[model samples]
Target: RSIHVDSPPSVPSLTTSYVHGTSSVSLLYQTVGQRLDSTVQRWPEREAVVCVQDGIRRTFSQFQQDVDKAAAGLLALGLRPGDRLGVWGPNMYEWILFQFATAKAGIILVSLNTAYQANEVEFALKKVQNATDVAFKSHSLTSLTQS
Candidate 1:
């Protein structure tokens, strides 16, 4: 026996549709750091991040604290406002941590493609004049910085 299904009716496209987004509410322009801080302040105990693969989880307050520590470490390494920093790796807790850290430090983040080869990484680093590179596990920070 075979199951028969009827197709759903198609809806007509709206005549007012445009390439640009139209919203009734006004946009709120806020930096990532500001948003993070606000979120932590409003919901300190709320779960902010969870990495099941890594067996890691953190609340908004905990995430913010770690971000602050990472930002301070970057600052101690001589990173200043507008300095170029590169993050080259896959999606991980460390990647998320560095993302917020860079924003908090006011450093420009140059995301090096995870699929990039050695030459491509070198080219990207040169193009962006990246002063520091953050990697994970096999790609140590010392090795990346040296490169």
Candidate 2:
């Protein structure tokens, strides 16, 4: 005797199952000190960074401590997750610190052109309407300004 075969039917759906978007780097730590705890694993006994212009040299362990301090300072200033931080200036050691701190504290960063004049700075500030605090190279000629 021969067996009969049946074909399976296909169905279509309107909604798509998956989508791709910009990738995110996670800096969340279990506690404020956890960031320091994790860095030792990857950068143990390494010269993590040095800033010649500022005469600053720090090993990985030292760098991790500085980051923790900066993160703590930001938290003390009332910054919290989902807050926007705007940084505009020539890249420097402090600039890098602010970037890492913002990420670790879950704040969004908006970079503004340091060359922008007062009028331009106003425009950029308006563009990132949610920015709560601004970090810059010089307090007087900083990149962040309100419109």
lDDT, candidate 2, at 2: 38
lDDT of 1 by residue, 74-144 (tens): 88888998999989878878888888989998999899889999999999999878888877765232332
Q: Report the C-alpha displacement of residue 8, candidate 1, in angstroms.
A: 30
lDDT of 2: 0.65
Over 4 Å off in model 1, which ranges?
1-25, 138-147
- TM-score for predicted model 2 compared with the true structure: 0.64
- Which ten contiguous residues of candidate 1 have the minimum total lDDT? 138-147
Model 2, which residues run further than 4 Å from truth? 1-37, 137-147
Scored by CA lDDT, what does every candidate get?
0.80, 0.65
RMSD of 1: 9.8
| Cα RMSD of predicted structure 2 | 12.6
What's the TM-score of every candidate structure?
Answer: 0.75, 0.64
Please give the RMSD to the true structure for each candidate, in Å.
9.8, 12.6
Residue 10 deviation, candidate 2, in Å?
26
